[model samples]
Target: MSERIITPRNRGFLFLDAHPAGCTRLVNDMWRSVAARPAEVLGEDAPVALVIGSSSGYGLAATVAGLARAGIRGVGVSFEKAPTERRTGTAGWYRTAATAELAEQAGREMHFLNGDAFSDAMKDQVADLIEERFGRLDHLIYSVAAPRRTDPETGVTYASALKPIGATARTQTLVFDEDGKPDVREVSTEPADEDEIAQTVAVMGGTDWERWVSHLAGRGLLAQGFSTAALSYIGSPLTADIYRQGTIGAAKAHLERTARTLDARLGELCGGRAVTSVNGAAVTQSSTAIPGIALYTGLLRGVLGGDMVSPVDQLSELWDQLTGVRPLETDEEGRVRLDTWELTDKVQDAVAERWQAATTETITDLADLDWFRGSVRQLYGFSVPGVDYSASVETDVAWPASR
Candidate 1:
């Protein structure tokens, strides 16, 4: 067994290390899911594709699915911090490293670019790379999440906060004690003001996504019949005011609106399609930071009869839509509803009943708290079945060799 060093960061919400065994398990598990789920058809122009923010969460899963299922030549852009002696960087870094290594073994093109996805330089770099290598893109996926953004036009930075707008939202939240056991608790967040709402929209909105489409389309880098998507979430009513009706929701409204414009623009340019997909809520590092989401996801899982899909499965379904194996199912707003099951009336009714009755003491019984906690741990590369946590792990690891 190798030596291991793991320390909590961000109040135990995050950890820093590379448990080789754990990370290897995680990578292989995702790889298996990707390879297992087959796509309905191949891509165009040797299936050259690009994914912005493709290091973790939905983006990472979609990249893996592209390589293993869609047989695409993949290019991913991310801003993951590199590993150093003091820490092993983010789990996303490790995920990309492992994925790049696998792509090399399979003799396929998989380039993972580490930089700011929102930067103009990064966009130019991607255009240049695509022009020099494959010359065209067959698919694009945007799944970016940043805490703040400095608008290019205004030179002002805006940070997004999770809070209600019209009223104070009190909801059940999850907290972990020193022992790593989760306790459901209530948190109160006051309303966000006009400035706060605008800032949140600026940070999390679709300006950058629109920017990417304009650049790519103008440069003629996207191929004909290309399919593209951006991931968003509209959770159950348990925390609607704080999520779907709050600051983040306002940003999402912008995103969905942007999607409509992109859909038409892409169709004209290359007969392509673009839509913002409403994905189901799951345990992501970003989502965990939200106040009421943990409690909601917990109760959601229980209400849904213990069925929970990861980013892997969700993206695979998107792949199915892109490939025409499964037809698109859209809501009245014209947004794709890949979160088909989560939006079912049966599930929402059950969740509403459970959430109404759930207090801190009863939350554990009402929801899948154990699974929720485990999923959170899994995001940071802990709680895997075979990882020897006691053993020291290598902290200073090299980035994956040429993808």
Candidate 2:
């Protein structure tokens, strides 16, 4: 195949194509970041992890961190489109390929399953793999973020809504102007109906996480100290009405409840643990789509500057907790709060002050628009420091491991 330059094709927050080299660079950078940190030696008893939705964002970060920092090797499950001769693949596809390459370099065994993670067939396949390859499962990381899900049992598909719960929600959002600059815009959404709330919970809630644990336990594949973590978020006041208090918030609350139930269930079965890992806000593919998250994260980046904790940083901490290098810090509800810095009173006060004064004219000054743009672009494999976007490259790159 002839190498060709691949530039990003995007509209504001939605990207249509991904650069393979850019994605490869991103995976390498994440590996180097986690490798630089001090990690406890797990040696022969290293955990076997299964990272569902492990192609992008925190899932990908955790996969890389587990392998680079703790020598964890296991399987990952994600649903992504493969690249062909005429077009590019999804960003997650390229990212998984790059991660597989890194794992090979480090003498770690990493397998991948590219298909619907919400189906019974995928779960059964993973169970078979565990029995055949790893013998037992140590860690299961659930970081799935999809717009819709079809129940494997009933085949009923539920789509998640991002609207508020009771009253209408009005907030400031971010959009790109004609000059390709970030500008503040106002957005309002009506409250979601009861059905919408239920659907959102069905798709994004912890029911599936519980199902996976139950399935594994039924198959008797859990290790002596098996652990599971499901990723979640609780935004600040700026996005609380549309996020933490909205339809998705109801889903997250359900996820937390499931965690408590599973915590006890796992203890009885395998002396295991279960918890919701509430990650901090960052510019991810999922976050960029939420109504007010773009503006909120931009302002957050501006205020926190160098003190902000990144996805990889949080994943590193998760590895410590999973391996007994550090204790799991929890809120009153037993959910891990990784958004501590963002929720601090000082940070919230500064953000609120700036939020009130923010407008098109003051957007550049009030928020880290440049950083926001760079981060969004980076998610789809663009805006990296040394990548030559104008240079020729191949788009139909194959994932290192078979699906």
Candidate 3:
């Protein structure tokens, strides 16, 4: 192993390296949190699940909870860069490795496939693995967050653009100085042109999800009571122009519609079900890139405080919904609403007030910049407690094989 002292390196919001020890710590925390919940008796037959994009954010949290809390055997697929002798791997790589190690200690059957989830070859490999080992798929979680996707059949690539639909969106957002100090600044995002909007939808929309389910069905891999969930987010008016009513929103709209169509098809296919889970805002790698999300989430953290539901908490509840431990709660459109806490009138009113009052001078007072900063660090395996940043670490960490 090539060992070296590693610290956080970043270019604006993009992180350059990840610490394996810190990634292990983050996964351990997630495991402990799930273990703290009252234990469930998953009898002799436990569900087999497949989680696409199961390396970070909601997907990673769901994998942790599903194995540690819900007692499920599963497969997780993600695309991450493996570490070289001179470079550290992506955070998701370390996180996936750590999660696999912990799952092994817990005596769980967790397999991992590291490749593009949108590719036909990847889907075929997963389907074959399920057929040979697991027999059937009980649950499917689609949580992919990608910038671009190449259509396997058409040989064309689509790149997602994060911009408004009809008009330019202007807002006071968060920016970091060279020293990594946070400050409020105004940023304007131009609207996406027609091609960009279509491309965004192509990359981020539900067509890929539909393809996955369809492929699994063709393979006769869906179980009697199979269920699928695609993670989605709907921010409030503060960031709606760049979020809920934006290019990403158009993709999300298609995702939700696909869920409806899938729900109807699955209802007939095996008494199965499908729904889009609208998760609450939290510190995620994807969220930090959006135009106004940093300011909005910072204000949200300030206002919600103890009431905030983490990705782990929300995904644990999602497991509960899937396993029949509790009733599945959904809105009129049949979408699961996990953002209720963030959207409550009491919370939004306070957040909106702060959003309007926020400026560079008052940003510290108006938002939880500290929490946001720390959370973003935790995403890339930095700022984690008990990890010695000064110590030499193995840059070439091996990803554990499927068990």
**For candidate 1, lDDT tens digit of each residue in 148-170?**
88766677888998999899998
Per-prediction CA RMSD (Å):
2.4, 1.5, 1.2
What's the lDDT for candidate 3?
0.90
Worst 10 residues of 1 by lDDT: 36-45
The better candidate by TM-score, 1 or 3, is 3
Instruction: State model 2's lDDT.
Output: 0.89
Residue 137 Cα positional deviation in candidate 2, in Å, after optimal superposition: 0.5
Error of 2 at 173 (Å): 0.5
Q: Residues 1-403, candidate 2: write the lDDT tens digits.
A: 7467787778778888888888899989999888443544454566799999999999998899988987887899999998876678999999999999988887777898899989999999999998888889999999999999999999999999999999999999989965687678899999999999999999999989988988888899999989899999988988999999999999999999999999998898889999999999898999888898999898888899979998988998888888777887778898888889789999999999988989999989989888998899999899987898888888877766543
In candidate 1, stretches whose alpha carbon ends up further than 4 angstroms from where it belongs are 1-3, 7-12, 16-20, 35-45
The alpha-carbon deviation from the true structure for residue 357 of candidate 1, after best TM-score superposition, in angstroms, is: 2.5
Better of 1 and 3 by lDDT: 3
Reference-based TM-score of each model: 0.93, 0.97, 0.98
Worst 10 residues of 2 by lDDT: 35-44
Candidate 2: regions farther than 4 A off: 36-44
